[model samples]
Target: MKISLQINASPYQHQAADSAWHFIQAAILSGHDICRVFFYHDGVFNALRDSRPPGDERDVVKRWSELHAKHGVDLVVCVSSAQRRGLLEQTVAKKLGGYQSALADGFRIAGLGLLMEALIDADRHITFGD
Candidate 1:
């Protein structure tokens, strides 16, 4: 099945991000296709490249990057939401004189159009948080 996911909560602060990650892993193992993961609201924190957790703790951002690297899953951060939270894409950040590397690897910043496309294209659209 082709599945699309939306996450609205922040990593660590809430369980939604972690649950979405695990769900994606399980779905992939079951031979399912992940169409895209749309990060909205605080969920955009999952795409921060500079996120550094303790060595013992799992790095959620890195896990997301690796998911895109290994499985070719699309990790998309909502442009408006990210901007509200101070996360900007490379080009936009440069133009706005903001942090250039705000976004992590394998994740892209886009408008809601991509999210709508994923929802319309996927067989199932699962949302993990409010």
Candidate 2:
């Protein structure tokens, strides 16, 4: 099965991103495919590379990066949300006149069109709460 997980909250203030991470990992382990993970609203913060959790805690952003590195799953952030938070992809960073965010390589700053596309193709479309 293919899944698209849409996140809507800042990762630190809520467990939505964390829960999505576990679900993604489990699906990968079980031979299911996660089509992509889309970050919207404050959820775009999940792709911020500078997030540092306490030594004893989990870093949700890092985990999302790991998923991108290991599984080739697309990590996407809504372009509007990203811009509001000062996040950008390579091309977008240049367009915005800022340094390319780490999200440049690990994730893509996309429009809602991509989200609609994901929904059309995915077996299940799940939205994680804000």
CA lDDT scores, all candidates in order: 0.93, 0.84
Q: If scored against the real structure, what TM-score would every candidate get?
A: 0.97, 0.89
Candidate 2 colliding pairs: none
Q: Which pairs, if any, clash in model 1?
A: none
- Give lDDT tens digits, candidate 2, residues 72-115: 99998999988888877677778768575647347778899999
Error of 2 at 46 (Å): 0.3
Reference-based lDDT, residue 18, model 1:
85
Each model's Cα RMSD: 0.9, 1.7
